[model samples]
Target: MPAFGLMPISYRAIGVAVLLAIVAGGAAALSWHIQDWRYGRQLADLAKTQAEALNQLTLAAANQQRAEQDKRLALEQRLQASDQTYSKALSDAQRDQGRLRDRLATADLRLSVLVDPSDADAGSGVSAASGAGGMVHGTVRARLEPAHAQRIIGITDAGDRGLIALQACQAYVRALAR
Candidate 1:
């Protein structure tokens, strides 16, 4: 070693050092870029998965709502049908009751005639009378105007009252049937 301004260095050693530095810097930059790209790709994949999951859940919710609406509509239709049936049944029952009332009224009119035909036909000249509670074995007495009886029957006949009495008996039986 002699006293010199600069230390003696070899050209090959300088070239090797320069080459090593360049290689090391390039490797470090490439590793950093690769890591950034990997992280960005991972974030993108995660966002895509979240969006797909959200879409599926929304579709499922819409399907459930549609099913519920269908069920509600079915229930409403059933209720309406039940109401119509009930109303018709009630109307039919009322009509039956009215028919029964009318039959009973007709029966009552016939019973009144059989019970006291004399009072019913008092203005018609023929007075057919009978006693109460003696309808089956009762006697009917017909008192007619002589002129009227002669005009209708050709004779003032009050003795042949058995036919009239048979009519009264038949009327009583008809009333009972009603």
Candidate 2:
């Protein structure tokens, strides 16, 4: 055997060291690739979660809008029904007013025919009474008869009441139309 140094160097040992270094480098590279793949998976999971949350938010907004539309539609229907009811009531009131006017006109005509011509002309038109001895004579001077005066007052009162009632009815109808 040749003289060996304190630390002997051999070709087989050098080869073994080179092989170990190559294996260590390949393992390190594989570890780095695995870490990168794990990072990418985590990012994908985070994006999926955010997308799901956004979808939920969109769905909630759509539902709220639909509810609002339904409410508005229902309100419009109610308003339409109210308008129809008011229109019908107004029409009925108009018909009643027409009938009342016709009846009043007929009553007025009958009353006019029953009234004496002399009595009708006593106030403003030509009087038919003849003056005798400076005393103006008229158809008994309606004011002198107590019974006739009372009856006339009663009739006037009734007419005033009727007019008041008619005015009130008209006002009520106007209010309803509004």
Candidate 3:
């Protein structure tokens, strides 16, 4: 109510306001610090979870690639084995053909074919030529000359080789299908 009383009361009110303001500012700063710590923990947990998922994915991809590589290696081994077997067969055929040709050249063997009796050159299923010395059956046997026999053998050799090559190709296709 008096001017002197107002001065003392106003001083006391100003001191209390300053103390309250300090306390409020401290409380606000503490709340912000707590929130920052909690949010930081959540962010770290999310990052850890993502890293683990990525690691698992990488392992799975590596395993799949390894399995594919193993399968390819097995296929290559099988193909190589098949190729070797086919190669052996082809060589065996060639050796046999060579022996047969040698025998023909030495006259140890002769080539013959059945001839029709109605033909002027045919016999009664037999040929009494000096070089021909084999019994004939019901069909007239006609002996081919060395040159003609050699040509026939060559044709047969070509046919045999072609068949073997075809069989090799078929086997290769079957292996791939599996």
Candidate 4:
């Protein structure tokens, strides 16, 4: 006699239940494996794309650096040429000034300035040779002292050098701008 009037369990039912469970587990495992393989392939492709982008960036940077270096070199060369040209001009001016000073020191050259008759003394400024309002009588021209003439030359020489230096600076700026 049964306690609750229930039917007895069978071996066949138990076997069928075990087989279904195994099939379900196998299907789930296969699905997980396929998903893992797809994810791995996607990751590999992403890494490749990143590597190619990095390579392109590196090449662009290198080319930009090279272009900048070349431009700097060209500017330096132009500046050097300008410097040489100004240097030569300054040297020539100095040489010519030296020759003129030598001539003045030797009495071969005389510096003179034009004078107005009204501004000059009538008796003293007019030489006895020919003072009747003539050029030879020192009415229109006055001879400068040697010391004063040398001082004037010195001043002019300094001015010339300053002008040359200013020109050189301007050329340097232009080269840099280019």
Worst 10 residues of 1 by lDDT: 151-160
Pick the TM-score winner: 3
Q: lDDT: which candidate is best?
A: 4
Best first by lDDT, ranked: 4, 3, 2, 1
Model 1 misplaced stretches (Cα beyond 4 Å): 1-23, 102-178
Ranking by TM-score: 3, 4, 2, 1
Residues 110-175, candidate 3: write the lDDT tens digits.
Answer: 987866667625545454333344554445666889889888888888988899889889988988
Candidate 2 residue lDDT tens string, 1-178: 4575456769899999999999899899999999999999999999999999999999999999999998778666665665566556555655655554454545531211123555667674433444575644544322223344345445665665566556556655554454
- Candidate 4 displacement at residue 78 in angstroms: 1.8
Candidate 4: regions farther than 4 A off: 1-31, 124-139
Cα lDDT tens digits for candidate 4, 1-178: 5579977768898888888888889889989999999999999999999999999999999999999999988888888899899999999999989998999999999888877666666655643233564456544666889999999999999999999999999988888777
Would you estimate the TM-scores of all the predictions? 0.48, 0.54, 0.75, 0.72
As a whole number from 0 to 100, the lDDT of residue 83 in candidate 3 is 87
Whole-model alpha-carbon lDDT for candidate 1: 0.60
Error of 2 at 170 (Å): 20
lDDT of each: 0.60, 0.62, 0.83, 0.86
Which pairs, if any, clash in model 3? none
What are the per-model numbers of colliding residue pairs?
A: 0, 0, 0, 0
TM-score, candidate 2, is 0.54
Alpha carbon RMSD to native, model 2: 13.0
